[model samples]
Target: MTALSNRALNRALLGRQFLLARTDHTPLEAIGRLVALQAQEPNWPYVGLWSRIHGFTHSQLTTLLQDRKVVRSGLLRSTQHLAAADDFRRLRPLLQPVLDRTARSAYFARNSAGLDTASLVATGLELLAGAMTPRKELARRLAERHPGRDGRILAGEVELRAPLVHSPATGTWGSWGTRSAVSVTPAETWLGRPMAPVTAKDLIRRYLAAFGPAGTMDVQAWSGLTRPGSHR
Candidate 1:
């Protein structure tokens, strides 16, 4: 094995993360190696990937999402991310606790009070099983079921309660096109695969590979995963 100094390790980390210079990898490959691409805003990942991968095109990523090779799902600090289906499946489950706790927060308490979280998740999945549903539509349905409530809150809760993926068009450049609304798909339907299993050890290893020689707190800060001791 090659010995590396701390600065060398940091530089390598930055290089792999696309901080050093852009490369020629396809979006799929870049995302696979990076584990997940930050996607809080629909177009952020596009810009992010563009900065790192040469000749990156919007169509390439949209096609990947449409074809089920890549998926936009909740992860990495309980935010939206673009990741390979394989990575999303494994990572989503690991963030379950974080999702659950977020659901318990004042947001859900104030907006989705008296809501049966499990049933809400089930209904959201049922609504999204056949096709991608706009966040507006999903929220409308939830509000309709509950009556006298804000759908946006319900929509946000659905995200916390279920593993949801933003649809291709939503992530497509200019898809918003003067619209303030958002749309999303369920992760399972989007990827055509069941959720992947994850363990703390496995998550830690992947985190280290992607953002390594770091403290456990850094991992916790990135992935909402908590572990004792700083070293892997």
Candidate 2:
């Protein structure tokens, strides 16, 4: 077997990431090609798209969010990401273990001690159904139910437990890293469908294609899924 040189590897990775040259693909297409765009901040996904897509307009992506063609939600290591609305349905369920792990982390556990996770998620889903709810308002409502628990902490845990997406206005282009207030609704409600089931093998294949070949550690780090090799 011929060994691939470092330069060749770098080029391949660049091409796969759409960093080698701008492509004529639509913003939505580019988003699909990359699986998802890193979008912790409102403007980050716009920057990511502009660098990869030729003639990419800020409005083009903003429009996708406004039209509900795309969503900004917690994905890929339980951080915010931008993915096509249809794709989000497929991706969210497969990556849910990562979100579960995040919820069980020390910070959330400490703050939300004694909170019933299953109940919190169920209530959260109920609160968001058929309506866009502000984060503070949702938290306040939840605090009333959990008496003495921090509203923000309870709300944050629910975010990890259930599928949620930010409102279009909350995800629009902005200079700030994060908004002081965010409005969200259940993902299933916004997309008008349930989250689709996907397998670990499928998740690994998609990750390799979008992220290029990688070691087990790399896959785990990027996706927050432990023991990626076992997915083989």
Candidate 3:
């Protein structure tokens, strides 16, 4: 087989990601095509969309959030990402193992040590079940339940262990202005649907469609999960 040159690879990626040319796709459609947008910062997705989407406006993306058509959640690479609702439903479960692993990092381990993780997750869920709650509030409630434990750490662990998404309003463009709190709710509750089951193979195929011509290491880099088989 002929080897692809660097320019070829770069153009292919740009084309696949819609960076080669401005696209007419709506904000939701663009997000769906890309699978997910890197969104550690709440405003990054809007800037990302603006660069790829023709005539894109901040409100367009915000509207999708308001309508629950798109969600901001811990996903690929176990970081916050903006994913369309259906993609989030399908993708989050496939990435759960990675997210769980991230929750076990030294930072969380040292802070939440000696606490029952299952009980903590349950308590966190209960607190978030009624409504989207601020992270600090969840942490406070958990601290109240387990006095002297770091509520912030417990809350952080719950966030990592549980499939949760930031409240849409928190992710809306300009929503963070003058606001110190960020709200979150269970992904299932926000989506009104359970996480769809998917296998590693299925995830790889989807990853390829959005970021393919990629090697196994590339997929691993994007997903933060190792695949069992060899890659071409």
Candidate 4:
């Protein structure tokens, strides 16, 4: 193998990420090419898209969410992300370990020291059934099941433990009018489709296509995914 320089890798990332210049690709196409979009703040993906796609509009993404073409779920660092409905299934399962490990950090660990993750996830699904729920409401419901624990902790854990998608209306731009708003539904119910199945080798290929000429650490950092036999 040949050694690659940082500048070369940086340029490649910028090109693939569309930071080099806007592209004429359709919104969904652009999203698919990138593999996933950062969406910790629901609206940030809109901004991220705008910066990369030509003639981008909020409606494009919002419509995708509403139409069940795209979904916001826990993947890529256990953070909220927007991905094609088909991508969420494979991506979420691949990311579950990362999500769980991170959730075990200070945020959820303190308040949820003894909580059963499986039960918490079930409660979250029940609370979100037939409705979209913001994190606060989801957390509150989870807290209901585990009295005396912080709702925020429950919400965070539930998100990490289960397949959930941010609801369209709440994820729409300005939906909450500047408040921290997030409405979630189960991933399957939200997408009205099943998640995709992807293997580690396949994920590696996809990651490289989107963020390639990358070292193992770069790949790990971008997607919250890991596999054995990585290069330094």
Best by lDDT: 2
TM agreement with the true structure for every prediction: 0.86, 0.94, 0.93, 0.86
lDDT of 1 by residue, 68-130 (tens): 787766777777788888988987887777777777889778977777878877887787765
Over 1-232, each residue of candidate 4 has an lDDT whose tens digit, in order, gives 8877888888988999899999999989998888888876767888989999999998899899888888877788877688887878777876777888888888678888877777777777888874777788887777777789888878877777777777776556766563356677777776666656666677778888888876677777776767523311
Q: lDDT score of model 2?
A: 0.85
Model 3, span 1-232: residue lDDT tens: 9999999998898898899899998988888888899988888899999999899998898888888899998898889899999998988877878888888899888877887888889989998875789988998998898897898888888988888888887777676662358788898888889988667787788778878689988989888887724321
C-alpha lDDT of all candidate models, in order: 0.77, 0.85, 0.84, 0.78
Tens-place lDDT digits, model 2, residues 1-232: 9988989988888998889999999999999989888888888889899999889998999899989999989999999999999889988887888899999999889877776788778888887666888889889998888888788888888988788998898778983643657888888889889988667777778778878757677778888888855542
**Candidate topping TM-score:** 2
Question: If both were scored by TM-score, which would come out higher, candidate 2 or candidate 4?
Answer: 2
> By lDDT, is 1 or 4 better?
4
Q: Give the TM-score of candidate 4.
A: 0.86
> Model 2: which residue pairs collide?
none
